[model samples]
Structure formats: structure tokens, C-alpha cells
Target: MPTVDPTVLERPVKLHHLTFLDEGEEMTVGRPDIDAYVHLPRDGAELLKRLADGDTPEQAAAWYAEAYGETVDMSDFLETLEELEFLADDDTEVTTAEPVRWQRLGAALFSRWGLAAVTLIVVAAGIVLTQRPDLIPHYSHAFYTPSLIVVMLTLFLGQFPFLFLHEGAHALAGRKLGLKSRLRVSRRFYFIVFETSMDGLVSVPRGKRYVPILAGVISDLTATALLIIVAASTGGLIAGVSMALALGTAMRILWQCYFFLRTDLYYLTVTVLGCKNLHATSRDLLLRRLRRLFGRPVGEPISATETDRRAARWYSWLLLLGYAVMIFSLGYVVVPSLVFVVGEVVDRIIEQAPLPLLLDSVVVAVLIVGQFVVAGLLGLRERRLNRTVSSQPKAGSR
Candidate 1:
């Protein structure tokens, strides 16, 4: 086996809530995206089933495993039982130790830096909204006319700035848990984010998972709020800028809810379900779909196939919706946009187009590509660090 890192869970990864089952003995929380979970041992599974089957976890581990499987370690079983509050005579109160000095400092740095960054964004946006008031709904224009595309593009591109803030929220949440963070870049490449690392967030308690999940939305919310404040402060809706900004922020929040695209919200949903790798669950669903399409029997591991069926069902639906969105965004928006820019660039390179146009087009591409490239590099580095530490062996390992 390849070496792995000891601090695998200590890297900076986003955490979210996934569905949790509090079986009197077996409690498994799945994170579908990561495709794993903290599962109560099989020995405990019998008791869990019994509890659900009208028994209690206070039953001896012997009996529980007798009904389930022999996978449970007795001590861990008892501890988990205590965690679910099934062991009345014993309970592990949420064990929270004081954070280390470095942790406190990191927490401070994270909060301070995050706030500063957000403030900068708000001020810049305010200035733009104020200056480009004319971009807002004009005093006399008609419905969905010429400015719609420009405004939509502006809003679309503008939302990218908040992407980091989303990741920052995840980083900050990890920091609060006394973990060091490995922040990754935020950009989309070919409808896929080849680089985005949330490798270090696992060590934190499940209860603390919401911060990373909600961070970007928090940033978007904060930004929108600030924009609203500035717009209000300056009097009424200046131009269409306020409306556009408002709509953009609203859409940002809505995007998270869509769940069709695996945005931060998707991660959060998987976290809540305790499904570690939603990608895996999704793959499983896709496989079943493929089988069905081929007119094959679902058979055997059919029960396993049905595992997390509720969440799984949503996965298929969201996936369908997601691909539709992808086709529209990619073909209609991204491809056309890229083609236009590239055509203009090629023309300039061959001296068929003006240098000024070429220079501007190249600048936009560089700016966008540069952001993703940097983020991807950071993500790769995080994974490498984790793999390095996790490869170490235990003293008793064979």
C-alpha cells in the first residue's frame, strides 16, 4: 500500500452537514462528496437495528454484534453509544479542549483578514455601482433591451469575486476548529474545477461543519448587504446598478440552493447526510441508471444500491438539472464567449485585427485563467501534504 499522511483530516477542507442516523448503537454520518463517513461499528449495528426495531443501545455489545456483524470494537462501541446518549449511566459531554495559542492566532488572523478582504470588495463595488448608475435600469428604456447582456455578463463575472469568499468561509471554519488551513483557488475550467482543496477539514467536529459550508454564502450575503447599504445610503436606486446588484446577490444565494451543480451547498448537503463522497454515491446512481438503460437486473447488492436512497434520488435529479445547466452555460455562454475572444486574438496575432483589441482580450483571459491556475496549484499542494503525512505507519502495523 502507498504511504499516507497522519494529518489527513487536519488539512483545510470545507465541511458540511450530512444526514445522521442515531441508531441506539449505530450512528453513521455520510459525506457523499468525500464518499465516506464516521460509522458506528457493526457489532453496534444489531443494537442500532434493535433500537429501531424497538430495543435499546444499552444492550450488551455481544448481543448487538450477534445480530449485525463482528466489525465493532467494544470500547469504541461504548463510546459511540455514549455519544448518542444511549448510555444513560455514561455520556461523553461534547469534549472541547482549549484551543492552542497558534490556533487562537490563526483564528484571529483569519477573521481579521477575511473582514478586510470583504470590506475592500464592498467599497470597490459601491464605487462601481455609483459610477455606473446609468447601467442600472435607465430612466426611460424598454424591457430586456441592449444593456441586458452587458449587465448579465457584468453580474456573472462579478459573482466570481465572491467565489474566494465562499472558500474563505470554509477556511475560516477550519481555523476556528484549531486546524491549519490550506486555501485553494477559485475558478472554473471547462465546467470543472480541477483545483479546489478542502483536504484539512476532517479533524474538526461534525457540529462545526456549517461554517465552511455557509462561508461563501455569508460572503455573498455580506457583499449584497453592503451593496444594499451603499445603494440606500446614496439615496434611491441610483441606476439599474442597485437592481442588478440585488438580483446578482439573490441569484448567488439561489445558486447554492439549486443543488444541481455541486457548489458549496452541494458539499454542505453531503456533509449533512454524512455521505463522504457524493461523487461516489452519484457514480453509483449513474451506474444503476446505465444498467437500467441496458435492461439489466439491478440484483444482489440491490440493497446497497438503495443505501441513502433519499439522498441518492436527489442526486439523479440534480445531476439531470445540472447537465442541462451545464449545456446552456457552456455552449451558450462559455463557448461562445471564448470563441469570440479567441477569434479576436487570432485575428490580432495575424494582424487582421487591431492590437488594442488583442491586448484587452488577452488581459481578460489571463486574469480569469490565472485565478484558477493559482487555486489549482494550491489544491494540489494540499493533497500532496496530506498524502505525505497519512502514509506514516502505526507502531503495531504489520
Candidate 2:
């Protein structure tokens, strides 16, 4: 084990530029350069502030003791900071973060005029939908073509551009606030999803964080509105394609409501409730309850804030509901779709249908099955990778 030097308490402390945001009785302190953040009690935040402001660890600890009538272990605190990479070593150069690209565009989109324009578009779309309710999204919209292959291909292939737009909205929103973000492919349960990682958002004030978090949802709504208008104004295959796109986008919007999956709205809920680690805390709470019910030995008590523990009591029920919904969706939606496609394909093959007709059925079947196969392979690969990474030795450890 790596040991902390006793002399660290006597040395003057240096730190990279840090951002601090007050969250009720606690404060969030983070170094954006490293994208590391932690919640600390008000007293702890004050002590760290003093240390960063040129006070040696000893002096900061003495002040904390006098102010709070409790002496803190400065050595331990210094060690924790070192682990978080918040401390700046004298020999190490501190580099500034590069400016994020498209920041001006991000700023414009979130500005008052930009938001007003979106509001107008949404209102206009609503009026159009009211006049032409046929444009509304329905599962039937997905089958706009006679050929199942064309429908499947269009829906499958077309969703990526919208997905990119959705995730890009999130990235742009974060960039507006000078926070960097990156997009990556990830899995949500068995479904592959694109996600934007904006780790530096923790350093941003709570109120300003919502735009970045909800930007994707807003983008979805905008896309759906635009497509609905197109479908209403146009006819033939163009209208059909637009309707299909609208349906896909609308479904993506609905997916956000699965808050238990730690979706964007989930983070918004956590922020609104002023709860930290609610999902993990609720999961652990639920597991412990299940263990106790079966008279099994529950592990150690969960370490979480009182707010998180209190919220978890109710949030745990939502987690169960979320899982139930996932299962229900699989049975109600996925199974039926698979059965229909397979039955159709089998009928076409058995009857020795026309070459074009038979080829379409075969392609649809392969595409449908291939999606699940890819998802399964990706899931297994991610699980093994996670295991390997977890098994590796952490820094400063043997």
C-alpha cells in the first residue's frame, strides 16, 4: 500500500483551478481539467478552500478546528486530494483545457431567441397535428411499405442520423458552457445506444446543467415536429418515410421516461431532488430488503446521504416498475414483431414465392435477427471488458 508522507501536513498546498458549487449543506468541488468531482460537507469544502488559498495543511486544519470545534485529520484529507488528482505537484505543469468546438453554435441554440424559434416551430407543428391527426405517430407508421424488407431497412438505417442528432444536441449544449463532451456507443440493457459523456458538468452550477441534460429530448421533439410537418405536406413514399422517422423519434422520446435505466430524465430528477447517488443507493436498498425478506445475511449498511436514503425508499419501487416495463415491452412488442416476421418469411419460402418477394422476406428476417445477435455479442464483449478492467490493479495499489 502507498503511504502518505507525514510531512505533507507541513507543506504548502497547491491546487489546479477548481470549481465549487453549493448544494444545500454540501458543496460540489471539482477539477474540470481532470473531470473529477466529489460532494463534501460545508466544513470540508471550507477547509479545502483555505488550503487552496495558500494555507498549509496544518494551518487549514487548525482553522477548521477553531471554526467547527472539531479537529480534522489533515494528513488523511491531503491523501484523498492526491488520489483525486486535485493537488498540483510542484514539478508538474498544469495545462489548461482546450476550447470546445462549436461553442458559439451551442450558445446560440440555448439563447432566448433560439429557444423562442424552437417554441414557435413546436407550436406550429402542434397546430398541424391538430388539423391532421393522421400525422400522429403510430406503430402502423413503421409499416409504410408493402415490402417488410424496405420498412425494416428504412427504420433500421434511418434511425442513426437522428440518433447522432440527439446525442449531438447534448454535446453542443455542454460545449455552450465550456464543458467538453464525447459521444460513444454503449448498451442500455440489450439495446445498443449512443451516449454523450459530459463528466465536467458536475462542476457546473445545478441550474445551468439542465440544458445540456435535456438537449437530446428537445432535439427529438424538434425532429419529430419537423417530420410530422413533412409528412403532412407531402404524399406518397416521402410522406411514408417521414412518418416512419417521426414514429422512431417519438419512440425514442418515450424511452426517456424509463428513468430507472438512468436515462437523461433520471439525472434531471436526481438534480431536482438534490440527491446524490440515488440510483445506486436505491438498488442497494432494494437488494438489502430482498435479502432480509429471505432471511439471508445482508451485507454492510449502505453509505449514503440522508436525502439519498430517504429518496431510495420510494425510488426502489420505480426501479422494479422499470424492469417490469422492460419485460412487458419485450413480450408485447419484440416477441410479436419477431413472430410475425418469421411466420411471413416461412410462408413465403414454403410457397416458393416470386424471387423478389422471397428475397425481401429473407432480408427482413436476417436484419431483424442480426440486430439481436449484434446486441448480444456487444453485451458479452462489454461485460468481459468491464471484468478485465475491474480486475486490473488501481493506481497507487500493489
Candidate 3:
């Protein structure tokens, strides 16, 4: 622990947003400004509150000792606080303006009525799908008229616009809460995903945070519902394309279940549990288990932080289950689909005329090869990140 001057009082730190959460058996300190938080003991929380309210480290420590019959380690506590960025220095400047340009548009679209209307559409779509089971989209429906390759290409191209809207839904939801957001393209394994960064949502209440977290899913699901409805109501090429859109959007909605990727639902769980670092804690737990299974050295599985341990005890199982599901999917769905696509592409190329074959093969090859190249790039990036993180010291370590 670094030495502290007993005579010089540490300055009180001001945070963008501060909230105390009670978890029946524990207390958590939430700092939304920096999208960070820490779990503390009852006494520790009280001491922090005092410090935040302008009490000097010495004064807070003295008060804590009087109440708990033991002296608090001010040096270690302050260091930990600083490491977490809970203690803001003079150099820290808070940005007050909403940075995103589409703030007003977003808020209006995700408002209470907007959500209510979406809910109504989903319910209506469910009714239609149940009543007319024939309307439920199948892969065969997409390939019924056009050649499978052409239909696949068309559907793939169509999703580009919807993908933007999906991410925009998240940004809009954040805007409704006076938070700004940005859209970025990110990769999850080999899959390219459009994402919205709404870290500012942390500043909002936990209950309100659900809106932005779930907004993209809501958008995708809604699109699925609308497209399915259109497909059922119409016939011919329109119906086929609508069915394709419906299936594509529906799959995207289910894709969120990949919680191992820190998907939307993962963030929601983190907020609800008041967990500061569930992902890292759960990942560490998995590593410890793997080490033990493989006869390698295993350290503590639980986190050094009490709150993290509490969240991890339960959440770690979900992470394990997610991994299991992913492996199952790779075998059951992904591998077979890849094999089928490659076979179809080869067959089409062989069956077509010279000029047509060259054009069609190039298109199919680009789609398949592009996915593999992206996967390779992401794998390398993950390796680099793993190495960097491994070099850094773990939190709460002396």
C-alpha cells in the first residue's frame, strides 16, 4: 500500500451518478459516469459515502474504527478506489452534452407508446403465425422459385439495411434516456455484427436500462413479425422475399442467446445483479475449472471482490451452459450448413454455363471465403487481447 499523509486530507470525489444497491446480504456502489462500480461491505460503503460527502480519509477511517471496533486500512482502501477510478482528480472532466446527432429522433421512436405499439404488433404476429401455420417460414419457401444461390444473395443483400436499423434501435432507446450512442461494426467470431455503444445507459436507473439493452432485439423481432405477416398475406415473389426476411430476422433475434459473447441479455443480467465484472469473473471461473480438469495449476475460482463472487457463483453456470450450447450449435447447425452450402456452390458451378458459372461461383466464393478470413482475423485479435490482459495485474491484488 502506498503511504498517505495523515495530515493532508484527501479531496472528496464527485461522480456523474451514484447509486447504492442492496442485495439482501450485500451492498453495492454504482458509478454510472465511468460505467464502473464496486461492491463493498456495509462499513466500507459507509466510509465511502463519507469520503464522497467530503470527509477526509483520516476522518472516515476514525469514524469507521469507532463503529466497527477495528481500524480501517485507509492506504489500501484509497488505492483500490483510485484503481477503480472512483476517486476523480482535478484532471477528470465530465462530458455533459449528448454526443449523438439523432438524439431527438431516437427518443421519439422508443418512447412508451412506441414500445407499446411494438408489443401489440408482436402479439398480433404471434396470433397470425399460430392460426396459419403454413405462413411460418421455411428454407424451402425461399428457394421455391428463384435459384437457391440467387435467393440467398438477395436475402443477404436485403439484411444490410435492416442491420443498420437493428443497431439504430439501441441508439434510439439510449437517446430516450438522454444518453448518446454510436454505431460500430464488430465481429463475434466469424459473424459481422452491427452494434450500438450506449455506455451512458449506465447512468440511468437499472429499471430504465432494460429499454436500451433490449431495443435491438425488439427491433429484430418486430421486423420478423412484420415480414412473416406480409409473407402470409401476400403471394408470389413478394411472399418469398418476405418469408426470407422473416427467417433472417428471427435467427438474428435468437442469436442474442449467445451470452458468452456479452450479448444484450448479458448486459441486462449484469445491471440487474449489480455486478461490476461478471464476464471476467465468470471467465476466470471457467479457466480455473479447465486448469483443474487438465491437471494444471488452479487458483481461486471466486473473485477477490465479494459482490463479484456472489454474482459469479450463479452466473458462472450460465457461462458454462452458453459454451456448451455454442459447441452443440457448431456441430449440429454450423458445420452441416457450411458443408451443404459448399456442396451447393460446387454443384451450381458445375451445372451452369461457362459465363454464368464464373459469375455465380465468384459470388458464392466471396461469401464463404470472406467469412473464413474474418474468422481468422478475429482469432488473431483475440489472441493479442488475451496476451495483453494476461500481462496486466488482476484487480484487488497488492
Candidate 4:
């Protein structure tokens, strides 16, 4: 093994490694992280080398497919490279030095009037809906598309802010527990996600675990309620859309709970399990299934990543089921809207109820079902991370 230069970006670096095949020419692999490149498997490595030398993911995928005479999904290459921080501006910023603005405010507010604020929002929404029954329906009908757009954008763009609030909760809880806390961005499933470095978090007694786990939700609930209130007051199409958007966004935030994808809820559950690394174990289990399907020899034995993945595995299966439901839901909800989107082009060639729409719905439904299945399977992984804290209650830090 050779040590790599840490600062080796901005130019091509190369390294020669043993090929996956024993009878191999010098195989070259490019490591964007260390900026080292290597060529092996002659032709295969040549293509890979070209990809590493700055070909876009699309180019790389095409090269792999064309050279190997196999269809290579670009997503795998792109996702891996992106997660490895291979893209330009790849480094995600990590923060812990300065306190997040909302945490400071939420702490004081939560300590003081968190309940009152929530009550006011609920009361206000109820009164508005009751007093002006015609309003919501009118708004829902009039600017539904714009409203939906706003909601979807909120779902996409607000992820960062929401994530921040989550880590803030962790930091706040850490503060309460007298532990220093910092926020860092780490790659997960090809995306950057915020997390509280558990170095300090883990060192603290297990009784304090719930604070960090529950912090993000507290932040989400508060932000959502406040946004809803603010959106409610504004009157007009924009205001109406705002209100709907806030509610929809809030629901998306809450959607985290329905699945166990490394969520706060899953972590909380894990702390109760006292089983470290349950996720890794469950992942092994999943891979074993894949191997069986492919007739490949079984590789590694299962260990643990944590109970969270196991819980998430259950959720994955549920999501797969949702796909089955989505078959219907897509026909009912998503597809109709999509029809309005491209109905003009489709209407020309197809019949009154275009086969495209039905086909699209079916595809979407299958996708939804697949998601549920994956979630269910991942949920079963059971990282057993928190099991180490078995001396404490299994009910959680509470």
C-alpha cells in the first residue's frame, strides 16, 4: 500500500492496482480524492482513466457501456463520484464555531412560549377555515398549480435549512448535556447531510441521547408552525399558495418519521437497542440476497451498522407497498396533473384517455412500490448502534 498526497487535485494523478481479474494488464484507476489515477484491464482501465481525466459522468457511463458492450447506468458512476466529492466545489461546508440563529431563538422560545405559539397557529388556521369556508376551496381551485409548484420547491430548496435546524437541535441538546457540539456535512447515498459529530455526543452519558436525537424534529415543528402562521396572514393568490406550500412542506418534514432512513427517530430507537453497527449487518443481509440472485459466491458475514437501518428496512418494505398503492394514487393524483403539463403533445397522437397516462401511472406506481420494498428491507438491517448503552433503559434516553 502507498500513502497518497492529501492535496492532489487540479491535475490528473495515476496509480496502478491489481485488476479485479487475475490475468490482467496494468489496470489504471484515478482517485479524485487523492487525485491519483491508475490503469488496469487495459481497455477497461483506459476508458476509466479517460473518465477520471475529467470526462463528465455521462461520458464515463457511455464509455463503460460502449467498451464493455453492457448497459451501464450513469447514475451509479455519477452518484459515486459526487458522493466522493469528485465534482467541482465538492467540499461541503461544516459549521460548529458560531451558533445557528434559530437554535438560540428556538431555545428561548421553546423554553418560554413554544406551546403558546403552536396553539395560536392551530387556533388561527381553524378559525380561518371555519369563518371563510369558501376561501380554501377557492384558493385550491384557482392557483392550484402555482401552489403545488411552491410546495414542491419548498420540498427541494428547504432541505438545507431544515437539515440545519436538525443539527441545531443536536447542538442544543448537547449544550443541555454539557457537551461541546459541532455540525459537519457527510455524504450519504450520494447526498450531503448534516450531522452532529458524535465524538462528544457519544462520550456523554447515554441518558442524554434523546436530546440530540429529538433536536431536529423540534426545530422542524417550530419552523413549520411559524411559517404556516406567517403564510396564513398574507391574503391573495400568493398568500393562499404560501399557506398551502407551508403546510405541504411541513408534511414533507414530518414524512421523515414514516421511514427509518437514518432519521432522528431511527437513531432514538437505536439508542434503545444498544447494538452497535446494526446497519452494516443488515446491509450484509441485503447483499447476501443480491448475491443469491446473481449466483455469486457469498462474501462477508453480517455485522452491525445499527438498529436504525433495520427499522428503516421495515420502512423500505412499506415504501415498496406504497408503490403498489401509488399505482392507484398515480392514476388518481400525480398522473392527472402531469397530463395537464404535457396534454397538448400527447393529445395529438393518442386517444381520449391516452395510453401514455395509464402507462406512466403504472411506471410511477411500480417505482413507488419499489421504494417501499427498499425501505422495508433497509429497515430490517438493525445497526444495533445504541445497544452498547444496554445498561440504560431500552425505552430510549428518556
Candidate 5:
């Protein structure tokens, strides 16, 4: 491995292509090539810009001392940049190729004409729903089949496509702006969900990020609207399937309202509030308060921007409310449903029901149990990974 020179700061530094954005009182400076960003005070950002403009560390530090009435530790700043992989060995400019697979499709979807078409569809769907209130989504729509197994199977399997479309919309929106994104399975509490990771968005201007952040919810609404229209226009099984899809899509749309779970809307909220990590900061604040109440060590104070600290003061309450909501949902919805299903299964077995009936009940039980098993396994895996990573030595650690 090439070792960094001890007196490197005395000479000019080479930097990768960096993007800067003024975010409220802070500035977001990032190396898009590595998708690494940091929120810095205006002075820090200016110092970095000066360094990137070929000023030696001594020159930048002198300027900082004169302008900010304090000196900057160039060694510490260089270490931070090294951690972010922002330092380049050569002066050659580097250009990364745009991700091409979905670029064109993404562009087309967000185009002016495409947006107009979507507006028309949404408006037409709204008119249809208003005229035919019967077509609106209901929980009952999920039970499109008489067989418990069939209903479970339809709902469980049928939702994947719509879920893909929802997450795909988010990915495409980011892709439209030449941002690379990855879709992965992640857990939000007990729910296993698909998420689009678009780290590059932090480097993008705030005004342009809303569409990418909201694309999933918009897709869900659009899917629900289209499904409602299809349900209204069709009959029999087709109508039933459409209604089931509409119900599923509608539920997903509503799921965004649980911002405490760090849902899409939570990202929107943080972005709008100009917070770097509100959810995490709020969680830490809540934990500290609880620890104090229990007479336990409260540990160190959370390090966060003033905006985040201010928002966390109230957001912490919302975080507690979120826990309460989860508990209430488990009690009112999950527990009751589990009891009812188990009771039915027990009764069916005792009565020596037909083979198909017995099999349906068994399959439904397995599906429900399997989902919980998968969630538990994923949680365990995540915890193990966290432990492993924490045990490893950090970069430049002695």
C-alpha cells in the first residue's frame, strides 16, 4: 500500500470531482465518484473550496484563520478527506460513465408529456372514484376468493409486481438525474420492504430531490387509481383481482404516513427540514432521556447540527408515539388475526375437514409463520454484521 507523505499538507492537494450545495446554514460537499458527502459549516466549505482550487494546506489554514478568527487543523481535515476518499493522487480529471440501463426509460417517464399523461390518468381515476364510490378500496377487497389459501396466495404473490413498480419509480427518478440506485430488501420494523438506495441524491440540489423522494408514493397512488378504474370497467374475477390490487396499493400509499419508521415521507421531512440525520438523532435523544429516567448512564450528548437538535426535541415524542402505534397495531390487528386464524385451523383439524380444506389451512399457517421467520432471520443477520464491522479496526486507527 502507498503511504501518505507526512508533509503532504505543505504541498498542493489533488481532489476528485466534488459537488457543493448550500443547505440552509450548512453546506453539503461530496465526491460523487464515491458517493461520499459531509455537512459542513459555511467556513469549512469555503476552506475546502480553497484547497480544491490549488491552495496549499498552509495557505488555506492562513485564510481560514484570517476570515474565521480561528485556525484550522490541516492534518485533521486531511484525515477526514482521506476517509471520504476525496484525495486524488494525480491531477487528471476523472469522469464516470452514466448508468445506461434505465436512463432513457427514466427520462421518458419524467418528461413533460409523460407527466401530463399521468395527470390525466389520475384525474380520470379521481372522477371515476367520485362517480362510483363503490369502487374505492376497502380491506374487504383483499378477500377476493372464498378459499383462505387463495386469498392469501393472491395477496402475498400479487403485491410483488406493484411493490416493484413503486420502488422502481424511485430508482428511475434518481436515474433520470444520472444518479445510480440499487433496490434491496430491507426491514422496517416487522415489515419486509423493498428499498431503493440512492446515496447520490445527497449531492444533488435540494429542490430537485423531492420528485425522487416522492416517486414511490406517487407510483402507489397511480397504481391504485389505475386498479380502481380497471375494477370499475371489468366484471367477475378480473374485477376482484383489480380491487385486491387497488387495496394493496392503497395500503402501501398509506404506509408512507408512518414517518417514524423512516419511510419515504421521513426522508422528505428531513430533506425539507434541512436535517442531516433527524431520525437517528431523535432516537438517540429519546434513548438518553429514558436512560436518565431509569437512573442509568446517559452517555455523551448527541453530536448533530443545531437544526437537527431542535427538530429532535419534538421528533423524539413522535418517535415514542410511533412505538405506541406499533404496539397498538400488533394488539388490535396482528394478535387478533393470528388468534382467529389459529382457531379456524384448530377447528378444521378437529372436525376432520376435507383434504383441500385442511391443506388450505395448513398452507395459510405456513405462509404467515414463514414471513415472521424470514424477518427474524434477517434481523439476526443484520445484528451479526453490525458486530463484525464494529470489531474491525477503522481506517488510520493506531
Candidate 6:
């Protein structure tokens, strides 16, 4: 390991917004621009602070000895920081850019006042739902009478905007914290997911990160609350429409439980635990354990960093719990609901509603087929990118 010279440590390094967040049990050193962070002990943080303030190794070491009555390993400490790429020489340049326009918009939408309004609406909605309990949506509520086909079609189409709003909430949360974020569509198997990349959230204080991570869930819950309120107040067509939306939003909220899919709740757990690579590392660990349990001739598992290993050891249990919940939901919730819908559609066809039945069948078929089509396209793109990368000649090759 390379170590910083005691003489050069006197010079200050150019750093991004370096801040220490006291997280009660621990402290976090964060660099917002790079989205890099590490937890540190109080003394370790003080060491870095001293170095950042242009204290030479010898000076800092003396101060540490006087304060703690023990010698600090300045050489190893500097090497660790260097390895983490937290150190830069005087020539290193730091750049700044104007904040994105969306930051202001996010501030407006997710302001304290806005959150309070959402809370009030939710409370009012809850009271209304308790009073007019019939307004509460059930799975069968998806059938808007006369034609279940139209109700299914409307729900299938209407959810797109709500899903967008869910991702938008994530983007807004990150933006409100002055972090650049992007919204994109991704998929896990046949399930479509709207995601926001807020990698910069890692650089923020751990407490501050919970809001961004949980913002999507909040948005879903709030939308469902508003829908229930509207359904209670209105009747006829509006009530039907609102009830459909309410069911859609409620399902979306429940879907957050599949934390194995790296849902909002998954990110929230990762943030709370201060885990660096829990998802991938814990998944690998779980696979290895499963192989061993099944007496499979598994190859040697790739080793993870000590930090990752520690996090994975605990996080693997959460993955197991997620799998159990997913299976139960599929068997009890999803399968039963799907069977009821299919049976209803078939019953409608036999009752001489052939045209509506055909339309509903087509809608279901298109959605099922569309998900596979999208997955295939994504797979092809990934393969193409891999080929492009692999075909490139080595740097030293002629």
C-alpha cells in the first residue's frame, strides 16, 4: 500500500462537500459530488479533519498521542484514505455546475407544507373510508359491472401515470437534496418497474436518505388515500373510476414488500444498515448457502470485502423472508385474483357478451406479450453492449 509522506500531508487536498454526520452510534464522512461515503469512529473522523485542515502527520500524531495517550498509525491511516480515493493533490481540479431546474420543482412539491397537506388528506380519507366502508376497494371491485372488460382496460391504462408519479417522487426527493437523478423504466422478469437513479443519495446523511428511499411508497399511499376520498364523495362513473385507481395504487404499495427485487423498501433497509453492497453480495451468499444445503457440487464462491461480508451475513435472512412472502403472495393473492378474473371473462363470453370478451382477452394477451417483448429487447441490448465491449482490442495490443 502506498502511503502519504508526512511532509506532503501539510498541504491541503481539494475535496468536494466533505461533511461529517453524527449518526448517534457512529459518524459518516461524505462527499456529495462523488457520492462516496464511509462510516468512521469519532477519533478516525477527527484524524481526517485534522489532515484536511492542513495538519502534517507529525502534528496530528502528536495531538492524538496527547489526547488519547496512544500512538496513532498515521501511515496506515493515510494509506487507507488513499486507497479509498479520498485524497487529491493541489493540482486536482473541482468543478461545479448550476443545479438542475427540477430541484426547485421538487422543493415545491415535497415541501414541509406539501407533506403536511398530504397527511391531512390521508387522515380525512381514512375517516371517510371508515364511515362509508363500502367505498373501500376489494379485488372484485376491479369489475365495474356491466363490463369487467372496460374496468380492466381502464386500470391497465391508468396505472402508467401513477407509476410515473411514483418514480417522480424518488427523483424529487433526490433533487430536493441537490442531487442529480434520472428516471427510467426497467424490469425484473416480466414485471415492469419504474426506477429513479439517485446514486448521490449515498453521499447525504443517512437520516436524510430515508426520505428519498421511502418517497415512492409515500406517493403510492397518498395517491391511494386521495382516490378513496374521491370515491366516497362521488358516485356513478367517477366513483367507479376512483375505486379502480384506488385498487391499483393499493396493489402498488403492497408490491413494495418484494424487497428482493430492490424495491424502495430494500433501498431504505440498505441505507439504514449503512450497507455498501448488500444486494449483490447477500444474493451470492444466499446462492452459496442454497447450493450447500442441496448437496450441489458448487465451485468456490468469490470472496467479498470484509465490510460487504458483514452486511451480507445479516441481509441474507431478509432475502429469504422476501422469497417466502413472494411465494405466499403468488399462491394466495395473485393466483386467486387471476383465476377469478379469467373465470369472469370466460363467463361473460358464454353469456353472449362476445365482443367485450374478445376485447378483454386481447388486452390481457397484449399486456402478457408486451412484457415478454420488452424483456427480450432489453436482453438483446445488453448482449449487444457486451459484444461491443468484448470486441474492443486490448490497450497494449497492436
Model 5 TM-score on a 0 to 1 scale: 0.91
Candidates sorted by TM-score, descending order?
Answer: 2, 5, 3, 6, 1, 4
Clashes of 5: 0
Tens digits of per-residue lDDT, candidate 6, 285-307, equal 88989999999877664545566
Number of clashing pairs per prediction, in order: 46, 0, 0, 70, 0, 0
Q: What is the per-residue lDDT of model 3 for residues 291-310, given as tens digits with 9 covering 90 to 100? A: 99999988866445666777
Best by lDDT: 2
lDDT comparing candidate 5 with the true structure:
0.85
User: Ten consecutive residues with minimal summed lDDT in candidate 5?
Assistant: 91-100
In angstroms, give how far residue 106 of model 2 lies from its true place: 0.1
Candidate RMSDs in Å, in order, are: 11.4, 2.8, 4.1, 18.7, 3.1, 6.6
Per-residue lDDT of candidate 4, residues 247-299 (tens digit) = 54465466556333465665676567753444445555666766888999987
Return the TM-score for each candidate structure: 0.52, 0.91, 0.79, 0.43, 0.91, 0.71
Q: Give candidate 1 misplaced runs (Cα > 4 Å).
A: 1-25, 28-37, 42-162, 177-181, 186-208, 231-254, 270-279, 295-307, 348-354, 365-398
Tens-digit per-residue lDDT, 1-398, candidate 2: 33777687788888888889888788988877767778888998999999878998888989998999998877777777887788888988765566778999999998888778888888889999899988889999999988777788888999999999999999989999999888888778767889999888888888898999999999999999999888888999999999999999999999998788899999999989978789989999889999999999999757788999999999999998888888999899888988998999999989999999888878888888777777788899899998997897433211
Rank the models by lDDT, top first.
Answer: 2, 5, 6, 3, 1, 4
Error of 5 at 85 (Å): 1.7
What stretches of model 2 exceed 4 Å from their correct place? 331-358, 392-398
lDDT of each: 0.54, 0.87, 0.75, 0.50, 0.85, 0.75
